[model samples]
Target: MFFRQHRYSNLIIPISYFLDLLIINAFASLLPIQFQTPVLFHAYISFGWIVISLKNEFYKIYRYTKVAYILRLIFTQFVFFFLILYAFIGFFKQPMISRLALAQYFVFVFIAVFTIKFLNYISLMRYREKIKGNIRNVVVIGENKKTNQLISVFKDRTDFGFNFMKQFSAKSLDFQKEECFKYIIENKIDEIYCSISELQNDELTQFINFADNNLKTLKFIPDNKKIFSKKLKFEYYDYIPVLSLRDIPLHNPINAFLKRAFDIIFSLIIILGLLTWLTPIIAILIALESKGPVFFRQNRNGIDNREFYCYKFRSMAPNNDADQAQATKNDMRVTRLGKVLRRTSIDELPQFYNVFFGTMSVVGPRPHMVKHTNEYSDKVDKYMVRHFVKPGITGLAQVRGYRGEIESDTDILNRIKFDIFYIENWSMFLDVKIIFQTILNAFKGEAKAY
Candidate 1:
């Protein structure tokens, strides 16, 4: 009944994931050179993939994620798959197959899965954009700036697949809950978003009863101006109730260890492999073009709103305003060599040191200058949520073409949306995806990369 009532809203990412593996194995079997492996080996491999992928949250796709983000996710899944596969093998006393044949299997299966998923992603995105596909009828049950903002975003971005059905004021609905219920039932609304402040006591009771009876989705938006975040956690203190607004996954011990280990290992690879030679070349170029420190350090907001000196190659000449001023396109402060560095994002390489030192992550919400943080926190509600995780050199917002200068209020607003999405749906797979997407965007050049 629930599945029938919420048709098209339940997008199971795990099904697509399983299909990718199934298709890969199916295609590989037809190849001219096939590895002879025991049936048990394949079954164990399948089980291993399922368990690890779930642990990594490989199947948690947000409603508004784009094609690029989807592909990045698949790329990450495959990247980590080998580690899981071999680790499973390493645990056994006797290996089942030749290393050479297994290598070929890995290569062929990865290529097949990656190609098919990419095509499917492109098709899905196009279908959603032009065909009114995956549309969800949603109604808001509150009157507030945030609710209006939600309506505006959904109305403007059809690609998100939210259909703004109607809104019911709590004050008015308090007297006549059935009126809202009638419209909901008649229209088959899929979800209801209510302001906790507006519908307390009996009004809240009716709202919950109606939704529960109909099996409709219910989401509560906090009414308080200062204290709402992605997740609302409940704790019991000797039977006393405790409510926490934070839902940051990185705070988990295992999750934190996973993320931090990846950050350290990945940063070390870059620092050793590329930075060893590339650093001197870039440093010399920067010095030749202008006179200042090779590295630029400025105070930015880090995890938990702590101040840290974020390091990047000095892409701009010495300026007293560097602390407060943002770099805009075609700015005179940027040198010729600086332009190349910024375009390729090599300017951010020094921050790998920060990642190695535990001050940053491989992927996260990009930290903003103290001035920008203070300025925007007032303008944007829930803006402080991004600071719950350690800042990153490249983030979901940056890869989604929201990086560089915040020229308008809309720009920052959209950036915050992507950041919040990353926080809410975080995983090691996501960080890997964002890292890959960052590299791809750098090569293709982003809109605000200047």
Candidate 2:
């Protein structure tokens, strides 16, 4: 069966890792510095190399990865590795180990590793082009400018190793889904490329299910309209851009774990260090001003559109419209203390608990009230895509002055645009940057903070 085919390609990463490690140790042995414990030295450097490579994604070169990206990885990896080498010598007080010899060792290792990497990359391209090995037989499922561009890539870039078998016009009356399926099965098509703009919702789902069942790779050729946005991940087939709709960085298990860990650790600090005392003080102030619960909880749309009761300091007098209406600037429902709370963004501090409980993140798209979520989702395009990640206490949209009342449709639309950007291009540094900016915004006071 096509699904049962042995994929030796899976072994490439591991094999590459092993070869790099081998090169590192072999060069270490040739160094003039006589290590007191040779095995210890080798193990330390090898472990350091692996850790650094994994952190930098040094070996994540793909067929579509640009040569410039590979060079950047190599530069980043070697710079860090050089620091690791010097740190080892300094920490161990290796007086006998000559710095000059170590530098030479570093140069030799870089030369050897660089030569091997490029050689392998070029060899694979040559092998695919000349021998037609490691080829994927693919079919295009639409006829359009974008699809034609992609088809041209498959035909021209033999080094990419895609064999274009046929083109099926999804819009054509003569095009039958069953016939396409039969052809795919009989010809052992390895991948299916569909024009997302050309297919109906049902047609897209059917192809997705068919590809999933057959273990065939599925990709989309998106319309050029959304290509300018960073919301979707784009890869170049030669010069043609092909997008993956759901390929956000946080979708990776490692990245998701890292973001979640940051959320938990950061929330713990706030909840224990600040909120423990601040919550009671705020509660007393709210009680003094109005009659209501210290913590206001309302159901909000969370990750995957799941409903969760989001927590915030009680910033309004008990009212019927708390869940249905957003707080407007100079609104009467806001208590005297609520005005102060909202202005300083202290009302949002209680959401750290939500973060600790894992219902939200420290930095992500902000969750909206259920009423607004339902209303906007119907009216706004790609608004629901923000639900792909956990809601944040303060998001890119909030920091960028899109928070508070939605005065106009453009306000919500701009918020959605920022939210989508955050979801797609998330990183640890980006989260930290947003947190710092949020702090600065609170101190300065935003016009929309009312």
Q: What is the C-alpha lDDT of each candidate?
A: 0.74, 0.83
List all candidate RMSDs to the true structure: 17.7, 10.3
Model 1 has an lDDT value of 0.74
- Give a tens-digit lDDT track for model 2, residues 1-450: 221143445456667778989998998887677777788889899999989988998876766567888889999999999999989877777778888988998999999889988998888788789988778899999998889989888888889788899999988989999999999989988779989889887887778667644546678887643423435566778677676645667755446667877888989999889998888888788888888799999999887677999988998999999999999878999888888889999998989889999898989999999999889876877777787778998899999999988999999999999998898788889999999999999999999997
Candidate achieving the largest TM-score: 2
Poorly placed runs, candidate 1 (over 4 Å): 1-234, 241-246
lDDT of 2 at 365: 92
> What TM-score would candidate 2 get against the native?
0.59
Distance (Å) between predicted and true CA of 304, model 1? 1.1
How many clashes (backbone N, Cα, C below 3 Å) per candidate? 0, 0
Writing each residue's lDDT as its tens digit, candidate 1 over 1-450 gives 233332323343544656866865564465443334545556766776677667666655544555566677777777787876566556653354456665677787787767766666556656556887776788988887767777776677766666789988876625467788899989988778776767766766666556544545566665453334335654332222233333557644446666877888999999999999998998898889899899999899887677899999999888888887899989888888888889999899999999999788889999999998898776776687787678899888888888999889898999989998898789988988898899898899877878
